[model samples]
Target chain A: EAGVAQSPRYKIIEKRQSVAFWCNPISGHATLYWYQQILGQGPKLLIQFQNNGVVDDSQLPKDRFSAERLKGVDSTLKIQPAKLEDSAVYLCASVTSPAADTQYFGPGTRLTVL
Target chain B: DQQVKQNSPSLSVQEGRISILNCDYTNSMFDYFLWYKKYPAEGPTFLISISSIKDKNEDGRFTVFLNKSAKHLSLHIVPSQPGDSAVYFCAARADDYKLSFGAGTTVTVRA
Candidate 1:
């Protein structure tokens, strides 16, 4: 079985530029998550989706960041007018049962903003 | 407010020895704890997990111990191997399945 897939393994943009990251979770996985991992820091949960419905996104920056999981299989995270602080690896993960902590992650998209 | 914390920034262990990584969390609401391994420029992979109900969960060379009373948990790698070298992250989950992570601890397994 293949693991979670993420597009554009790396991306570089200016501070004011916009960028989008895509993710495709594993088969039969109902839960999808997006995490931001800054340098020397652990991955922080940005948003989570249970199938097509959103489960949580309290820590998400609603003004600059947005994510959607249409039909609940694939997800896309977009950042508008990116900031220097937004330069981090965006990781996508999925799990069959969301109640526990068994998340399988993709290779992640490293975003570099100058 | 950082809920989970890994005080040690790095750890160095000789091969065939034990490697213990510690974590402390402040949120008592977190009912599940997990450990993840991450390589440079790569996303973190799930290493092992333990529920609040159990104090210890072991799988092969990896073992995770949870202390709900102290809000502390730990991951122990027995007879550490160079292949196990990576940044280890400790995470906690609340009732809503939202995971709170701590700063990672980079582990170096010396051959």
Candidate 2:
């Protein structure tokens, strides 16, 4: 019963630079989500994946942000030409199902864009 | 559009006292509500939750009350302790599977 795992606990990058974050959901979890948490603000959903397919990504910045859950176990979120406004903690969470999803969150990657 | 709102930015309560956090939502479609607590660096952990059909749900020292008509909900912590000091966030989920979160309220329990 391992929890959700995320890589690169912290990251520092310059505006316009490209960066990527990784996530590993809990075993047997069917739903994976990526969220952006700005300082002093709650997490905002960026994308969600049910297995290897995307369930929702309406809030994602299509021009620069992208994510993929290739094997349905691990996922990655990328931001190219990152903006200063993109400096925030990126969190990954997983759930077993839509009905009983309690959402186990990872430690998150804190990205600082200068 | 900021569907969920946590008015109080922060609260400080003496140990052994009660700590209450409030949240309001504008969407009626949201049927499930949850409360999560987060420390400085760690991820948020689930605290308690109450469905729309239920007015109140309690677990140990934590309790959640939901008001569907007013689109408001609250979390109450009794006998607050230092360990209970953290940022509390209210989240609402609809049948569509999206969770809308509040801005978060920081609670400080001085022991």
The candidate that achieves the highest lDDT relative to the unseen native structure? 2
The DockQ of each candidate is 0.77, 0.81
What TM-score does prediction 1 earn?
A: 0.96
Question: Which portions of model 1 show Cα errors greater than 4 Å?
Answer: none
Q: Stretches of candidate 2 above 4 Å error?
A: none
Candidate 2: residue pairs that collide: none
Worst 10 residues of 1 chain B by lDDT: B38-47
Q: After superposition, how far is residue A29 of candidate 2 from its true place, in Å?
A: 0.7
- Residue range A3-87, candidate 1, lDDT tens digits: 9999899999999999999999999999999999898888888999999888888889999999999888999999998999999
Candidate 2 lDDT, tens digit per residue, A1-114?
899999989999999999999999999998999999999889999999999999889999999999999988899999999999999999999999867747889999999999
Top candidate when judged by DockQ against the true structure? 2
What lDDT tens digits, residue by residue, belong to model 2 across residues B1-111? 999999999999999999999999999999999999999888999989888899999999999999899999999999899999999999999998688899999999997
Q: Which of the CAPRI classes, incorrect, acceptable, medium or high, describes model 1?
A: medium
The Cα RMSD of model 2 versus the native structure comes to 0.8
